[model samples]
Target: MQKNHHFSYVIGAILILAPMLAQAETKDINQTKFSKQYAGWAATIEQTESEDMLATYPASVILWAGSTFSHQYNSPRGHKFAVADASHSLRTGVAIPPGGNGKSASCWTCKTPDAPRLIKEMGEEGFSGSNFVDLGPEIKSVIYCSDCHVDGTAKLALPRPHAQNAMAKIGLPFDEQNISMQGAQTCGQCHVTYYFQPENNNKVNMPWIFGNTADAIEKYYDTRRFYEWIHPISKTPMLKARHPDFEQWSRSKHADMNVTCITCHMPTVTDKNGNDYTDHKVSGALIHFDQVCAGCHKSKAQLTATLERNKAEVDAKSRQVQNLLVKAHYEAKAAWDGGATWPMMNEGIMGIRHAQWRWDFATASHGMYAHNPKEGLALLNKAIEQVSAARDVFKQVSSQVGAAKPVYPDISTKAKAQAAIGYDEPAAVKAKQAFIKEEIDKHWHPVATTGY
Candidate 1:
């Protein structure tokens, strides 16, 4: 193991005990069951995911870089590795020319508690365009007590401006007076979809100006003509979806029954002393299904099988769309290469852009397969329609160019597809390793003792 991770190791160890922490009039941010000691457990959960987190980045993401996740994407390791992971990710500011705009400090906004604190101290605009490397030492910790706590006391707080601003736009506003909203808002801080608003100092903002569903947010992005990048092959301007767990959960049946994420992910755990506190491991609810859902469900076995079935069905539908979507990108590239003009290509490219956005938005929530499979399948249906429309446009261009049939290139594997788009996997891997050693281990966030 690398040295100088003393604090990280401490939290890593406590997470093994299944941590329990924090509460108030907020029964559990109701703050009903929280004590400082217990809150450390919450901090521990915040600090580490305490499970094997490596190599779980989805295999189907062969076309990953074409979307928002960019060069590299992985299953998120909990807060303990937040700073390190960001530094190590090939997606974050690697290979940028000096003075060119790479990812800004705004990219770090959700990864560390230090971000909000620094944003408050330096002003959001002041922090926005700053270099990611320059902010490392100051941001030397992951999500912890301070991210959601007020002062040194245990009173729950809202530190994320993105969450607060987004909530207000939805008309609920920031009312600490309402503990239920407060509890969910804590998770919502980083769990919702957001885009960096270039009009507003590159500060992060949610795409909920119109509403919460996948298409509503798409309409919102449309109003602004906001997009992340052009697909290298298709030349389509595209929008990248971030995780939208909070948004999907709000529309879930669980939400209708007054269940928040904490009721499941942070279920109450009783100690040997017979006192109950929330589990701080912060794992998937399905990991310990009985702990959270056993009270309501009659047969744990049947429920587990049902949830898994839901996930499999969503995954199958998504994969089918993904195969078609990948084909559309290459097909658009063929049209461009054949000297198809914008008039002929615009419709095709737009179709690719819209189709991919729906897929990214729907599947971005890892839990959507189980938590809101209906919504997931619905958005995917739209993806199918959009990609098919894109293909129709591509076919018209192909025929007009005297190339009646566009032969699909053989990009059946990730390596082939990446090469088709001019990405260098080996170089990217090398750069990420070098960056982690020189930047992360030597100069990035040092784990905090208080995190445990």
Candidate 2:
């Protein structure tokens, strides 16, 4: 009887809140568009495996580029954890209200379903300038059906403005794009590389004007003199490649063969009731080879062996490229400390910058080796070659200056690497906790709305 009464009370509370939740401007209270497959995946909060994922910046990253990655980085778990993880992540930082944490609102773009709604309510300018804390009250929903669904029709749409702009810049106007491309484009909306333009209140932007190729994107940044950061060790202008899955995949054989990201990651599945729907729980296709790949490759053993071989080869090349980068940074630092001027070293550092970009592009892409082995290997090889060229320049400058080789910093663990880069991880974590306890808890959840 008590349980029944509690249930009734909760239902009544929901009824009272329904009007507010279903306001004319934001009317998805029924959540009819939420995919069951996505819900199931979201519930699996322990699905934490990810390729090339690191809980913190690697030593190579610290010794070579001088990035602490905002003191935290972690493998993604599940859709359900996205908002919470982003909130607590040191990468996001403890954004104080009004001023925020120097990060843009675009950081929240992929983490919440409320983003699309917020974008609609606040114009692009308003959305771009909105503080993270300011958004806490409004954006309560995680990634959901409404984010990708077209109103009145359940068809998928790319609601992300930056992606649409990128597509348009590439002569592929999104609205006029074919229905067949919708799935990939929808995923690309968030999955592709983007940076917030500081000039425009850190508005979300992508460097797709020149093209999506590694070199082409590099060229675009070079032309604009845009850089994500400057390497503290190499003093080279640097651009960090975010997960560039769409850019790499678009150039892959699978894309040429008309394979969409959804085709693989969200393979169609049928239940015992004979209804067919695409699985919305997005992850790598390799995990569910039978569901996604068996139709193409009959022998699972052969397929697995082939994938493993490709992955091994790529992993080896990636490690080699990383080692070369570490060596190049150390050499450049030695030359610099020994009085190598910018006029003598800038060209070589630029080469290192471009090379590292390629290496990062290949390393960051999901299963690039297995997905597109040829391109993946080529990228790594190019990085190795570039590093070699940079090393030659470093040697020339060091020889001229008679500088001794710099000792590599000891950074065997994430903590040591962070310390090398001068990151206070504990302090950042504590600030996040304090923000959650005081600001977020006080403003985000109302006492009356707790039951609802």
Candidate 3:
């Protein structure tokens, strides 16, 4: 018993110091080293293009009411830019003031590597009480080793509470030994359609109570009477769809084939010395297509062409939904402006709500085109049907109003669109800059200099 106890003690000590010990030998490499090791693939990686899908649309359809911070509807880039992107985005940064940004410390939960430690120290309630600016100082590391690991082991763990809720809702039979599921579930920690439940508390919640489909998610939110914001002009309750990557990607061909996200996005590569390990620098599979696609597809050119074809088809359909949604919002606003009340246009309002929900589901699910193009296009068609019905309702209500035609505004750019929605872009930018300078820099700069 004494011998066994001493052996156990020695093993435990080594386990405790494993991360520190490993850092000396197998530390995460810098971008330069990474590029060299990755055969210059990292160098070709591009910053995610900045896009504002809403900027071109009318403010009535773009901006959410009662949100102090404005969100830019940009697609995510490589994980390397995680912190840089969040810190600069108006959605996360504008909410930095003591009570102004209209966001809680919970906002930082998925954005930082130190989330587990911060949550442990503050407790979930205390964390929610704090502001993004106050918590910004503590979150120095971007999404890194600590976010999903305990002492840098291959063993996976989930750090975010919302993911836990989602897994429970979906009735995912827990299996501690299933590392593949764990790896995939860990990705779900951030990559799903989620909303902050309470306005102030901001406890992350997935609309998975009903189901995971586009319609099912909308049904869940509708039953709960949840609305991210009411369209200021249209007067219809609206829900902003966040990235629904996991939901859309699940059960797709790749998923059905048991090709988890880690299998592609984090594919294992052999070093010059023939040591094999999964790459930790997560990015799009296409960025390192040779490494990922070469496992199955022989010709990279053919694979690239196939992906592009699917994406183009999906984008074309998504654009149709976007146009239809714009028309619906404007028509709905015209009806409201023409003195159409909820009592009179309840059915029409519901149509607009559900239609836009479908549109957002297809549009918001990152890489939905590649994951499941058929479903993506189908969702868009359903949205078109619903939005067309909404337009019909507006026509019916048009007889009661003075204006015969919907007054379309000249919202050609982001500024115009924001102005139409009563958004103060300058104010948001100023608040974000102030927060970064006064609060975020105190911690962000130090670690940034020392290097992530």
Strongest candidate by TM-score: 2
What are the per-model numbers of colliding residue pairs?
Answer: 16, 0, 1
The lDDT per prediction is: 0.72, 0.74, 0.70
Which lDDT tens digits does candidate 3 get at residues 334-439?
A: 7777777777688888888888787777777777877777788888898889888888888888776654577766566767767766778788778777766666
Please give each candidate's TM-score: 0.84, 0.86, 0.83
By TM-score, is 1 or 2 better?
Answer: 2
TM-score of 1: 0.84
**Which candidate model has the greater lDDT, 2 or 3?**
2
RMSD of each: 8.5, 5.1, 8.5
Q: What TM-score should be assigned to candidate 2?
A: 0.86
lDDT-wise, the better of 1 and 2 is 2
Badly placed stretches (over 4 Å) of model 3 are 1-71, 93-101, 173-177, 287-291, 294-298, 401-403, 442-452
| Residue 147 displacement in candidate 1 (angstroms) | 1.9
lDDT of 1: 0.72
Instruction: Please give the ranking of all candidate structures by TM-score, highest first, separated by commas.
Output: 2, 1, 3
